[model samples]
Target: MLGYPIPANETQRLAALHQIKLLDTPDDPVFDRVTRLATRLLNVPIATVTLIDADRQWIKSRVGTDTRETTRKVAFCSHTIAEGAPLVVEDARQDPRFSANPFVDCENGIRFYAGIPIFSSEGYALGSLCVVDTQPRHLHEDELAALKDLTDILNDEIRLREHLTREQQRRAISQRELDALHRSLEEQIERRTRELNLVIESAYDAYISADENHRVLDWNRAAAAMFGWSRQEALGQSLQALIFPHGVPEYDDATPIEVNACRRDGRETPAEVRMKSLRVEGKHRYSLFLHDITERRQLEQLRDREAREDALTQLPNRRALDERLLDAMARARRLQQPLAVLFLDLDGFKAVNDDHGHAVGDELLRDIAKRLRHSVRETDYVARWAGDEFVIVLEGMAPEAIQGLSEKLILTIEAPIQLGEMSLYVSTSIGVASYTPASNETAQELLKRADVAMYEAKQAGKAQVKIAQQGKA
Candidate 1:
């Protein structure tokens, strides 16, 4: 069999094919629908929405076929891409091109074939939507036209999928950017972002002027550095479309906006954008100033995380725990449901730190923290209260269930922990404080009651739970 010839625009065709991003992608129902319809309408044993890669024809969607791919050198669809129209071979045995093809001699016994080239929007014939049968057959004029129509639909589906993926990604990135912009930045950012309102050419911030129609008219040097685009490449491009391909947002306020813009290398980078509308030479024009904000935002997030998280255990620290208690209490009060606070301290934890250095001690604390978190429901809040002290807020738990949960937590900790070479066992003294409107206790007072109960548990020979006395100091 004669090997299929590559198209004259092979390089451009391959580039266009990769731009669609359909090769080797997961099967989508959109492509499946076309292949399924082709199998039924044409009465062929096999139908496939095949994509020709650099070396193979990947079956994007196939009916009645297990072979996912074959070498492009031997693929019938490879030749179809060259035809730029429907390629019909009524009998493989009579066709010189495919007469000696192994597919003709194989178990597939492929004899009749009809393929319509699937062209990309740029007129690159990437592959084919084809039907194959074991027995020799002829497709009528109407059937050939139907195949072409199906390929046209397949082309639309391919283009739609590419556009939708980019749009979904764009929406996700935009949401993150807007969320960061709206959040309260600390004094440093507040001062910087405030003064950044009026950007001068001398400032490092990128200044750009675009027409009201969103076309870029002027770009500063900083703009080139920020977006990875040279002045020549960015000028005359749609500023709005270049920055936000989906569309300019209908912002909730006229304040400055932060967005991740597409760089020349296709990486999205966080940038602050301030826009103003004015008249330049009596022509309505818009000027925008931009500055990269990735580093600043990352520092903000890091500081925010550290402020509320335990340094050693990486669990919610005391401050976060206190906030959670206030919210949980309010929710319980509104619902008229009972909630419990369990305060626990590791029994003989100091002894372990004394015996095995603080490194092992730190690892033990982290391990127990994970166990405490896993033992409770997602609704429960687990936090490190202090050194060797842990607190948990279990909402909607009845008095009857509190003891069982407390016991489970103790037992969970008793399981041996693997810290390096040592398998160490630990026990806990837990205090249970159940909240009711009758008690009228503040969050701090509730925590104090739980702390007292924990001391009582320790007095009663440790490794046990002591429920706090209701309405008692």
Candidate 2:
């Protein structure tokens, strides 16, 4: 048993369809233009202008598919004509009516379908102008409007052809039929205009259209919401002056532009503006699509900072420090410069924590972190390796400079800390590890040797500096 939808006025429908005399005709470029425009504008690979027949569906024009017609019972366009409205199947496999349908079950996967009914002046649905995609997707309001406009253009072509033939055979067509076709053409133009307005109103992007001189022509609801300017206030204003007050934009596609988008309150926001060329009635214009990426950019920067930085003392974490270490080793080997890694552990740290409680211990660590960071040169990399321990990388330094820096670290830790209501003091055992172009120590091995020297400093009573035995490759 074949399942299909049939028009109630099948006789009248076929009479009107055959009157156009378009059945079994060669591919017309006029029809192909609508099909091509549908495929490109809607971003779908398959588009067709199918005319429904008694037992078959005929393709007047098509894109992507090789088949010229499909069985009426198995045709999606068959259902489109009966409904007499836009038929959108987001996923045919999910619909009970089409789940077991051969086209939906095929290897290519006919998942998405959107068809706009093609009509005659007598209100008969002759066929459909539709698009199909293998992948499932929902059509936005603007996309639906665009599809409808294309169908309206196709119907206009059909009516235009009928009108020309009627004029040539004036004796065959009644005066009443001629009057009806004239009225239909006028109504089609009015409907096409309304459809375009609907597309603009429902667009998600800040749809800003302007003249060649940059005067605003159309400001959509999205543009008003994004720029804090109502449609009435934005009309006739200079587009560049309204958004980019500092200077005209410098175009780059590498990244979305971070422009100073002047707000209604005279403040600025970081907006990403993507401009495109829009041609209206053979006249050139600009379409600016704006999105406020201020919050997104801030979150991106914060995430990057958090990934590399320690939350405790705001110093570079182990991961960030390792990156610097590898980079420093490469530069040191290239420039033939001396590089040093100083591993410092606070002496008597556990005893101080045990005596003063953990609260005092935390404060002491914070204060120590600040002092150690300030103790090194601005060019050096200082990172807290773990609790009570820190590592500093020094590049392009002489052996004498290394010795003075080691002494400076020792003195800085030995300095008294005024911790409210009393004075506190601590010292750090320092281990100095050096690498020159002549040395054979890898980055990790250098740190291991530095750890060995730090143990040696701890063993020979606390608060002393020890140098690692070099060339341990």
Predicted candidate 1 versus true structure: per-residue lDDT over 1-473, tens digit per residue: 43788888889999878877778789888889999999988988899988888888899999988999898987998888877778999999889899888989777578999999888777889999999999999899989888888988988887786688668769988988877766645655777755764445356988887887778998878888877777798889997656766565433326888888777777888888887888879887877777789999999999988999999999999999988999998988899899889999999788889999898888899999999989999988999999999999989888898899999998999899987689887899999988885557899989998999999999999999999987443
Worst 10 residues of 2 by lDDT: 247-256
| Local distance difference test, each candidate | 0.86, 0.86
True lDDT of residue 22, candidate 2 = 88
The TM-scores, one per candidate, come to 0.50, 0.49
Q: Which portions of model 2 miss their true places by more than 4 Å?
A: 1-205, 210-216, 220-269, 274-286, 438-442, 471-473
What's the lDDT for residue 335 in model 1? 90
Question: What clash count goes with each model?
Answer: 0, 0
Stretches of candidate 1 off by over 4 Å are 1-204, 212-215, 221-239, 244-269, 276-279, 283-285, 418-423, 437-440, 471-473
